[model samples]
Target: MPVNRTVNVSVVFNCVQNGANDFGGSATYTQSSSTPSDLGNVVDSNGNIDLRQASAYDPSQYNDSVDFVFTLAPQSTGYVTPVVWASRNGAGATIVVPQGGNAQEFQVEQSSATPQLLTIVDNDDDSNTYNYKPAVELPNFDHYYISLDPRIVNKPSSTNK
Candidate 1:
């Protein structure tokens, strides 16, 4: 698709009009690998694409343009196949992190006013383990730290900080 987007995009899932509810599928997309990246968390279980999670960039730079080819795979063989129900384009937002300040005081905020960046300087600092978390979470937070980038950032504190 010729997508000229810079914000979060979503694919609405629903049963086909012909009552082909038996067939369901997940959505995913692919991007260039010329730059270092990992797309482990960008995809939804119900087949949705978030272009931001498909690539990486320096905290101060814009995301590298990506060409996402959305794909759908049917869950089971049925008389009817899955079809697009609806799609919503994204309205881009900006992330602002304070520069040259106390790293501990600064934080990375999402489009909404929420800070989800959590940093564990050392295992001795807390009982929580970082083994289960991915190497890097989405919504880059290097712009907030003084010495190191966040290992687990952009995670809602209310959910798990």
Candidate 2:
């Protein structure tokens, strides 16, 4: 039996199917390191590939690229699986910090945007702790960039919420 080589892959955001959709009003992409990075919150974690700044630059609007990395464990499994998914952060309103910014005010107009880049949380052990354990795949050294759907950049007022 061939053992899958354990390696780290970079998680990037580009564009995907849909091409059109918005979660609330802000679009989010979670890093492979298991962090929900907002549009402007660019960051990296232990298991991340350090692709680009969350709000680094612009690539069209609705259409964007994103992906999760897979790390193989020496001889644990011959192959690993990795898949991505999209979801609505909130209703019509973009994702809000719930409690932030002045007392009663709104934050950035880019939280609950659609085509959110959600993380593949491993809920195996029954514990709700978000572990950066994503489905790993056979290491090939090859890489690709996937995009996320785009929507409107809701720039509402602080009191809009």
Q: Model 2 misses residue 129 by how many Å?
A: 10
User: Scored by CA lDDT, what does every candidate get?
Assistant: 0.25, 0.25
RMSD of 2: 18.6
TM-score of each: 0.24, 0.19
Candidate 2 stretches with Cα past 4 Å from truth are 1-45, 48-53, 61-65, 71-132, 135-161
Off by over 4 Å in 1: 1-35, 50-64, 81-161
lDDT of 1: 0.25
Q: For model 1, state the Cα shift of residue 6 in Å.
A: 12
Best by TM-score: 1
Query: Over the full model, what C-alpha lDDT does candidate 2 score relative to the true structure?
Result: 0.25
Instruction: Tell me the tens digit of each residue's lDDT in model 2 across 1-161.
Output: 22111112233322222322311111222333422233342233333222232333222322232323222222322122222222122221222222343212212121223222222211111111121212211112122222232221222112111
Write down the worst ten-residue block by lDDT for model 2: 121-130
Clashing residue pairs found in predicted model 1: 27-47
